[model samples]
Target: MDVRVTDDADVAGAADETRSLLAWLTQEDELRGRVTPQERPPVPGTLGPVLDGLVVALGSGGAVTGLTTAVVAWIRSRHSDVTVKATRSDGASLEISTKLVGPMTPQELRAFVTDSSRLLEGGQGGQGGPGPDGGAL
Candidate 1:
């Protein structure tokens, strides 16, 4: 995998996040087989004012791993001020190019609700009811 950050005019924190993301990808077991970033040019137009950047993930082999979950999780976990858009090279193999925006997407809001619901469902005490002493609430 080759991840690059071609913009630097945004908040310094954004650049740091790109670095951290690349590091995490290289270190994670699911992504350890990938390669480090190839190029990270600073695109003045892309990053400026509030904060934003361009992120591209490239794959060299037949199939890649740690992408779907990683990408979605990263998007779902980002701050409210950040926005991410992922596009595949050919709508397959999970290759993605992401552009961050000052405002988040409406889809992100839907995802948040869905994730919260899932969490709530999982947090439920299970199928069986509680025992005599308020064992499960």
Candidate 2:
């Protein structure tokens, strides 16, 4: 999964917050070395390589579910309006915005996590259920 954080409210804060999210993800017991930032070549006059998004390797044993939960937790802890989008290798993606999720209750938050995990896992909200918000992931 490749995770990207976008913050239209503060361009400068996006990178900082993205790094913070990366740090938080890496700290998870199920993630550790499984997370790495995406590297891009610098433009003509840039000083160093560009770092954007994150490539997280999720395998068996509920790692994907754990990742979704951690991501929601990170978004809930943020003070800025940032949206995190995670794309799977198969091109399926899920976007979670801090602004949208901020007002959700604990149960709603858990459902959000569960729905995200299901969508990302190609289950589309688990069982024969509908996708979260009736939208494609």
Candidate 3:
């Protein structure tokens, strides 16, 4: 899957901030051996200029839940004024956009990511309890 994160800070600093966030995200343990950086192009359906963004290619077996949770938490911690749009795509696609204004603890972020991941994987029944690999939330 490919994950893209765009930093929507002011135009003057958006590019640099996005680059820095991308570099930091690449070093995360959850992304280790899985994420590769890519250039940002103009969004396919928009007329806007090339966005100040970063792209990460995730290995097929990478842990999406862990990686997404960490990335969102890190971005929120560093850039409260910036809006972030994180998009994950394989055959199916998921996109989450947010600007961190109110308080969101790390635990809450993890739970949110876990639930989102489960839903993405088509496990929305809410009764299975565990994932396909026999892992509980």
- TM-score of candidate 1 relative to the true fold: 0.37
The candidate, 1 or 3, that scores higher on TM-score is 3
TM-score of each: 0.37, 0.82, 0.60
C-alpha RMSD between model 3 and the true structure: 7.4
Q: What does the lDDT read for residue 42 in candidate 1?
A: 49
TM-score-better candidate, 2 vs 3: 2
Off by over 4 Å in 3: 40-51, 60-62, 90-102, 119-137
What tens digits encode model 1's per-residue C-alpha lDDT throughout 1-137? 33322223246566566555556456556556553443444478764433233344444432223433354455445553433222233322111123321133556534433432232233232322222232321
lDDT of 2 by residue, 17-57 (tens): 76788899889998888887876687689777656668888
Worst 10 residues of 2 by lDDT: 125-134
Error of 2 at 1 (Å): 6.9
The residue pairs found clashing in candidate 2 are none
User: What lDDT tens digits, residue by residue, belong to model 3 across residues 17-100?
Assistant: 777776677677777655544555666896645445666655544466656566666666673466555555543333433443
Who is ahead in lDDT, 2 or 3? 2
Ranking by TM-score: 2, 3, 1
Error of 1 at 80 (Å): 4.1
Q: What's the TM for model 3? A: 0.60
Off by over 4 Å in 1: 1-11, 40-65, 84-137
